[model samples]
Target chain A: MTKYNLPVGPQHPALKEPASFWFKVEGEVIVDVDIRLGYNHRGIEKACESRNYIQCLYLLERICGICSHAHTTAFAQGVEEILGLEIPARAKYIRVIIAELERIHSHLLWLGVAGHEIGFDTLFMYAWRDRETVLDILELISGNRVNYAMNTIGGVRRDIDQAKREQILGMLDPLAERVKFYTDLVTSEPTCLARLENVAPVPADKAVALGTVGPTARASGIKVDVRRDDPYAAYAEIPFEVITSERGDLLGRAIVRLGEIGESVKIIKYALQNLPEGPLTVKAPRKVAAGEAVSRVEAPRGEDIHYVRADGSDHPERVKVRAPTLANLFAVGESMKGAYVADIPIVIASIDPCFSCTDRMIELVQSRTGTSSVMTWEELREYGIRWYGHGHRS
Target chain B: MCGQEQQRSDLARRDILAELCARFPGEVGEAAAPRPGRAWATVSREVLRPVTEFLLGCGPGAYLSTITAVDTGEEFQAIYHFWVAGTELNLRVRLDRREPAVPSIMDLHPGANFYEREIHDLMGIEVTGRGKLERLAVPDDWPEGHYPLRKDWPGLPGGESA
Candidate 1:
């Protein structure tokens, strides 16, 4: 058998996002894969340093068109923590509704992408059609469809009123039924089931070792969800379940994500029903006191972490973003091992890799994040031994 | 914060921090107060790999969320964000700006491979152990010396004129 290389996409039918992948193939088996990202990198992280806090909010929203709200939420949360400003409860509920709805849209969009990859255009069409309903609900609440500028430094920019809440609830029942139908279709339909089952098997232990996150990790039965583990916004108050599967393959990922849409729907419903009453935004000062904060949110793809460091300036001293897609990129390379060349698209799509978010650099030009005075390893070692040995006396 | 949920988050942070301090004696550095279920500690560049291993050893599989780097004028600070049992624990390592080099933790957390490469490309930090570090997210024709994310170099990007 001849060993050869096959290259797929900076642009391809299989990849909706811009990223290049080279797979080393021995006959049909994928021996190794090399991924090159940043075809669409616009240098957003460096840009964040120059922009004011409010402007940076809009800039962060543009990081990923699909998971815009997730990015913005992560960014705002970090800055707000540094400022020590707490948002009103009503704003928290609104943030949850919008974030979960964004999750629904993102997952549905991914399902459609997966379907399209396997020549299952019907599933693609069905998923996208239902996805429009989410977009419509987003518009009804936030006055925009894709980049809903819902989150701000102190709180959400827009509030969901009673009529809008009713409209959103009315939309979910039909959406839920459609989601259920799709779930059944993916599992029961012979062709759909065959394309996904065991295409790229990632055992639970291996998935954990690779540091995989989001539906990809959940599919392998890792049982990790940021929203549940570290409750932000209204996730602690509202109730929802984390979806996982033991299948550890493409099929498991599909099932987990499809199930997540259901969970997201329930979270949105609960949030609206128990909607708190208060102002959306408080008057946050223009300048953030000098400090550092890390904000993590479970994006549709996985856990999204944003770190912001303020130096008592109107513009942020440093802004760092770690998109979920970056966490799963290497894991994708690992999962591709021993997989057939034909399975490349779906296997990569299984992680739902969003390059538009991942490739953006969080590069900040300030040293010693908090302050410059850090002790050498020897000093810290002696300090730790002394403190612990003294038992409560530092 | 609910009593039970907050307790669980705090306990997780404390357990991981305790484990690190217990194993290394004086190496874990300073830890900040818990903020919104996330907290961080600073570590010298030398103990980065070991500290990462300890965090990963925390029960139920510690996940490395992502790696971020910042240039603090004279030194480049590499921050690794880890999520274990629901809370985010960050490790910050400062490297000399002139000869910016740090050991790659890809051996412990494979997910850091690409991130290290990305940091290498944009921040110009040398990830010695990760073999064949290639340019990621930067143009192929991009100059050899210019690192886009660093403070001084004003190469291709976010500016007044397009």
Candidate 2:
């Protein structure tokens, strides 16, 4: 059998993210895969150097539309550490509430995407329809749904009032029920089980070696959660179990995320009820003393690390972000080695990759020769759906 | 129970600092734990690889979070942030501004591949021993020898050179 090079993207219409994936395949089995990124590199790190700390907060928040709060929270924490400001208790609790809500929204979005990849359109619709509930709560609090802009240098920008807290509490039960339904559907449904179970399985050792984080790592049974490990905000106070599965397959990822949604609901409920009475923010100094700090946040995807270096100025000397998706991309590529061609879409989607946040460099490896016909990204996505559709029909 | 775990990890973190200092006495500099849960130390460039190897040998949980390269107007600093036992142990290696380079830890930690290549691209730090560090984050048309993240970088290739 002749080996074929199938290039999936620098612009995949399915994920709507710019990332080029070149796969070396013999027949239907992928032998090797190389991911070329940087299609969306905007030099946010360099941009942060020129902008003041306040301006950089909003700029870094735009790093990922899904995890905007995570980026900003990490940045703010780093800056606050340099300034030596301990944010108020109420602000920490508010941050936890919003962070858990963001987790709910991100996990739900990934669930719908995963469902769509497996040719389960009904699950996709149901997951996305329920995701709107979390988004509405975010909008209610921060005035915007996607980039909530809820974080500032010293503390959070908004506080959860009694009226809003009661309203949010009222909404949690229905969302929890919806998550329970998803947990059942993915575990027992034939279509989901056939397509997801044992597909592109990444073992626990390989997952850690590759530095995969978040739900991807948890699915492999590596019980590493930044919330529990490195307590930030109210994670130290909140009591929730770290969800993990030893399956290390696509189905394991689904189960881990669905389980996390339940945990997020419980966290939100706990945070709101135990909401402390205090000021929302402290008076943070504009000019930070010459120092450096590293802030880590357990983003919905995984560990989001931010490094900030200040030089006694309003603007920072350097700001470095290691987005969770960047750490997980290589692991995804490794997991694709023995996977079928139809498994590409779901395997790549399994990491819940945010390529725009991870795109920091570009590579031009034009190693394609004759005999290798390039398939457009759209066709490859459709091929994945159709290939799996055959199994559903059978 | 949680406090005891925190104390154990805190001891592990301090032990990491002491272990490095004992192994490479004069090689480590500017070492301090500025706050709880974080520690920083600058190691001579020559011992960067050996220090990293030592840390990785400590345990499987000693993970390299990311490498941050900073152009501090006078010298280039490559800080290796490692997460060990809940503490972020940052190991800094300073390079001369004229010819900035650092040994690659990619062979030991495969996850350091992108972070090393990124420093090579944005900060113009030559990651020695990594065979042909590919262009990871810049445009194909981006000019050679121009690093965007450096302190003295001009706006762009053709723009006024800062």
Candidate 3:
């Protein structure tokens, strides 16, 4: 029995993110996986070094279109630390509201993606339809749906007034009820259960050793969350539960994320109820003092970290962003071992998003896995889904 | 109240500093608690791995979040951001600007794999021990010696120095 190569991505139905993972397949089980990133490299980190502090906020927001606010919040927090600026209490609460709202939007988007991957279009359709509600709220608040440019240097750009607060609060209950509906469907639905349960189980010790973070680690019973581990914005002031599961599989990750949505709603409701009164944006100085700082935020995916170093003029010397997807990449490959080829898409989507891939290059020296593939991305996806659909008798 | 919490974390910072100082002679630099629940220490590149291993051994929560490199004109600073509990302990290792070389902490912290490859790709720092590192963030056709994040390199398309 010779182990052969089965390349799953660069662009495949399972990935869709335009990064390649070359897996060494022995029959149906994945023996070894090599990841190749950088299909969509925007050079944002390089771009951030040249741009001024205020300008960089907008640039950072575009890192991941789905979780744009997470990037800006992390970047803003890091820069503010260097400036030694304490934003108004009102700003912090607004930041929390916006952050949690973004979290809801992101996690829901992930749910839809996961649903689609597992061949259950009903959950996917329902989740995204409800996700539009969050987008609508974001558009109502920040004026743009995707990259809501709400966060600024000292605080957020626009204020959520009394009318706006009530409106935003109005959206939570209905969203929670809908999510609960999906929760029941996810846990009980035979289609979702057959594909997701006990698939890609990773132990807690392996997760910790791999340096996994946020909900992925929490799902594996790692007992960590940046919001609780290192308090930032109003996370220190607002109370919320850090969701976790000891199962450490696709089902466990899904459950942890579904539970977190409810917690995020609670935090947002509290924030609206105790809406602080003060100025929205504090005038920040042009020059940040020469210093260094690291700011971590719990993005919808996991831990979003921004490290800033200022050389005093205007432009920051260096701004390094560690997206949660990057931190969880290793563990994802770790969990993929011994899983059915059919379960690849759902298992990959189980970790939410990845392949905000760095612009990187690699050599492609592959061994033939019985039959070879030189198909387009969509073709490869169709081939994958087609093979898995028929009980792959290798 | 936040200030009091800062002081409490500062006590833990002192313990870390003392541990490093006792282990490595003439390698540790000034340690400061810049803000509450944060600590910064400067160390020479000679003892980067030991310091990282010691920190990782301190607790289960001690994890390498990411590694960042800064070119400050005369020197290139490699900042390793380690998170333990609520505390973020930063160990900044300064490398010479002329030939920036830092020992790779990948063996100690697996999370440092991409971070180190990223540093090697963009900043042109020699991350020794990760033999023949592949490009993580740079393009395939990118020239060998052009480091984008260095201060001298203008952040523009095709403005890379030959």
Candidate 4:
């Protein structure tokens, strides 16, 4: 069989983000894959150099629309560490509540995307419909759904009052029931199991070696979670179980994410119930002492790390963001080995690849015919669906 | 027993710093554990590979998180953030401003592939031993010798109007 190279999107029209994956396919099996990034670099790190710490907080928040709070909270924590400011207890609980809510929304969104990638439109529609409840809860707490803007330099900007807390608590029971349904559906549904089982299996050792994180890593039986390993905000006080699976395949990822939504609900409920009485924020100093600090948060996708250096000025000297997707992309590329070409979309979606947080660039190369033509992400997804539909009509 | 576990981790963290200091006598500098679960050490550029190899060999939980490069106006620095047994142990290496370069640790940690390329792209650092780092975050037409993250960068090569 002749080897033909297929390049899918730096545009990524389906995901509405920018990333390119060049697949070296031998007949139906993928021999190799090369990922090209950086089609959407906004130079936020360089921009952080000129702005004040408060200003940089909002700038970093825009790094990823899905995990905006995660980025801002990580940035705020790093600055607070440099300032030696411990946020108020109440503020910490609010952060946890909002963080868990964001996790729920993010995971639910991923479930839909994974469903869509596998050509399971019903699952996609159902997962997305359930996601709105999370969004509504987020809006109730933070006044916005996507970016939230809940985090500030010293602490959180919004507070979950008694009434709002009760409302949120009331909403959780139904959401939990919905998530339980998803858990059963993804695991037992023939459409899901057929597409996900034994596809793109990443063993435990390879997962660690390739630096996969969050659900991607957890599904591989690596007991590593930033929320568990390094407790931040109220995670130190809160008690929750770290979910893991030994499957290390696409099915394992679905199970792990679905399981995580349940955990997020529990964390949110606990934080709301134990809401302490204190100020929402502390008065942080404008000029931080000359020092550097690193802040890490387990975002919905994985571990999001931020580094901040203050030169005894209101403005930071340097700021660096290492979003979780960047750490996991290499492992994702490695996982593509021996996977059927039809399994490409779900495999890429399995890591919950967020290219807006970490973008890429690529030029399609015509390996065999010496002729090149661009194919949008949607086209590739449709091709996968059709190919799978023809062979296995599940 | 919880206290003993804490004590064990504390001692383990201390032992990591001790081992680094003992192995490379004059190379390791300004090492400290600011708080629990976070430790940072400044090492000379030459011993960076050996130090990373040592850390990765520590345990299964050890893995490189990401590499961050900073231009401190006086010199360039590359900080390698590694998570080992719940502690974030950062290895900082200083490079000369005129010709900044750091060795590649991709063979040990495959995750460092994009990070080292990123440092090369945004901060204008030469990542030696990593063959042909084809522009990870910059455009193909982006001018050479112009690093956006550098302190001395004068806002792209063109005039303000362009």
Which one wins on DockQ?
A: 4
Candidate of highest lDDT:
4
Q: By DockQ thresholds, what CAPRI class is model 3?
A: acceptable
lDDT of 4 by residue, A1-394 (tens): 7787877557642211246788888988889888777877778898898899889988898888888889999999999999899999999999998889989988988898888888888888898898899899988887887899999988888888899989989999999999999999999987788889998999999999899899999999987888878889998888787789999999999899989999899989989899999899999998888999999999988899999999998899999999888888789889998988778778888888742121223234557777766555566667788887776535
Worst 10 residues of 2 chain A by lDDT: A355-364
Ranking by TM-score: 4, 2, 3, 1
Per residue, candidate 4 scores C-alpha lDDT tens digits across B1-162 of 354245335324435776678888988899998998888899988899999999888777689999999999999999999998667999999999999999999998888898999999999999899799878888767888888899998987556323
Off by over 4 Å in 3: A11-18, A354-371, A375-394, B1-19, B22-26, B154-162
Computed on C-alphas against the true complex, the DockQ of each candidate is: 0.39, 0.48, 0.42, 0.55
Q: What's the TM-score of every candidate structure?
A: 0.88, 0.93, 0.91, 0.94
Judged by DockQ cut-offs, the docking class of candidate 1 is acceptable
Of 2 and 4, the candidate ranking higher by DockQ: 4
Q: What C-alpha lDDT values do all the predictions have?
A: 0.79, 0.84, 0.78, 0.85
Leading candidate by TM-score: 4
Worst 10 residues of 4 chain A by lDDT: A355-364
> For candidate 1, lDDT tens digit of each residue in A270-351?
9999998989998899998988888888999888888898889898878888777777777877888897755666777778
Q: Looking at candidate 1, what is the lDDT of residue A354? A: 38
Q: In candidate 1, which residue ranges exceed 4 Å CA deviation? A: A12-17, A354-394, B1-14, B156-161
The positional error of residue A30 in candidate 3, measured at the CA in angstroms, is 0.8
Candidate 4 regions with alpha-carbon error over 4 angstroms: A13-17, A354-366, A392-394, B1-15, B160-162
lDDT of residue A360 for candidate 3:
23
Candidate 4 residue pairs in backbone clash: A37-A360, A37-A361, A38-A359, A38-A360, A39-A360
* lDDT, candidate 2, A268-340, per-residue tens: 9999999999999999988989988999999999999999999999999999999888888888898999999
